[model samples]
Target: MYTPPAFRIDDRQRLVATIRDAGLATLVTATVEGLMATPLPLLLDETEGPHGTLYGHLARANPQGRLPAIGGEALAMFSGPDAYVTPAFYATKQETGRVVPTWNYVAVHAYGTLELFDDPDRLLNLVRRLTERHEASRPMPWSVADAPEDFIRAQLRGIVGLRLQISRIEGKCKASQNRPAADREGVAAGLAASDRPADREMAALVAAAPP
Candidate 1:
């Protein structure tokens, strides 16, 4: 979260885009015992608050749900595309031999007051929305109504819903923005040539960053 001015991302639309595109987030909380975290898929209700509210669910058996978040807030970290940048990819390496290896990536952190709910009606609506969000891209979308009503109700009993009213959020994009124009182009080219999907995704980000 210690972001330099060059890497800080303050645009609200960009932050929301990153949060939506990043499929999973690491939800961390402080408890009397210690800090606990869970990787969860969350949905953002942009119209709910000043920033936004997060919605997700956890298994009832998970201790994270039962424990109280000691502080007023919890943290949710969403990590986006990332890739390793080799010195060989920098044009400065040949000019001055001053470049070193580094990483290029995007990350967004959200802080909010954590709230828990188990009301079946609310839980059912959340489940249905979450399902639709994830299934919209599929060739054949799935829905909560696809299964028996009794079976769905029984399944819902095993989980708890989460609501985090975001008080603060920060985004950082370290995508060769600090590098010289030539070096950034080299970095983008190198990453675009990689076989890894993440690397290629990072390449596009780098290419689009201000030179």
Candidate 2:
């Protein structure tokens, strides 16, 4: 996360919000064998610590869960909206022809000590919370209680719980903040016209970026 001052996002609340919205994160760790990475849906318990605590689960069969930790830390990366920015999208390209293609994106990296737990109770609770978070917006929201107790218990046995006590966070939002106002406007407008949902989302972020 080599973020320039203009692209850095230091606000804790905003960073946490982005993480929550991302829903899924790439968990990276240095293992004795080599580097290991797992994509998992993580929930942030903002009230747990000064920064926050992350909770997730991995399939019991996933070898990453059994690896010997090389270092004391793990990295979780959350990616938000991102879009390709063509030079044609920069107004300055027409004026001075000095602008080049770039990318606009939002991302957050969380560093923490890896804590793996297999407690059934904790795993059940974590799964319930995760279910509720994702289901709340659905038309017919589902719950863990909707399933049979035995079935749920059996399913829990197949996964291992993950808890990461966040040590630090780095957030970057490269949303055309470094560009001139007119160029930024051009970027936003161009993105807004694209059919891709991510591009449309980035367009809004770009429009909101400070000059």
Candidate 3:
């Protein structure tokens, strides 16, 4: 991520919050064939390591799990709220006519060593945690125990679990922080007025961020 100094997000707590909110991530790996990527809902085990561990599973036949060993590193991307900031939304652009369209968003890039299918128990635990995290949004939440043991074990056989011990994390928060206060406020108002839910959510994030 090419992040300017003003747009860099160095706060660990804020970066973690953005990652958690993203829920899903893109995992990329290089191979002899080429680069392979998978968009997956991952379980972030913040308690496990120095920067914490990332857990996820892919189908046993998925190519990524079979490829990463050829390469030593992998990257996981977590994206938060984002919106298009139009020039019309900036007060400075209206006044000086110098501003151009840009995007306002938050994203985290995690680089780590690949630890694929380390242990069966650890894999099961990862699944449990991921299920609980997503189920938290439901009225009547479900659990891994809800399924029969044989069925659960059978299902697990078709997937390969993974662990990525994150060595580096880069966070970028491009939320109009480089703009003048007045222009930022104008952009926020414009995003808030949009019918799209994502734009409205991004507006709130920008409004809450420090100037």
Candidates 2 and 3 compared by TM-score, better number:
2
Off by over 4 Å in 1: none
Stretches of candidate 3 exceeding 4 Å from the true structure:
none
**What's the candidate order when arranged by decreasing TM-score?**
1, 2, 3
Which 10 residues in a row give candidate 3 its minimum summed lDDT? 63-72
For model 2, where is the 10-residue window of minimal lDDT?
A: 63-72
- What would the per-residue lDDT of candidate 3 be over residues 171-204, giving only the tens digit for each residue? 9988888778898899889999999988998888
Quick one: ranking by lDDT, best first? Answer: 1, 2, 3
Candidate 3 displacement at residue 4 in angstroms: 0.7
Query: Each model's TM-score?
Result: 0.97, 0.97, 0.94
lDDT head-to-head 1 vs 2, winner: 1
RMSD to the hidden true structure, all candidates: 0.9, 1.0, 1.6
Name every residue pair that clashes in candidate 1.
none
Tens-place lDDT digits, model 2, residues 1-211: 8999999999998899999999899999998888999999999999887889999999999988888567779999999999999999888999999988899999999999989989999999999999999999999999999999999999999999999989999999999998999999999999999999999999999999887
lDDT of each: 0.95, 0.94, 0.86
Error of 2 at 16 (Å): 1.0
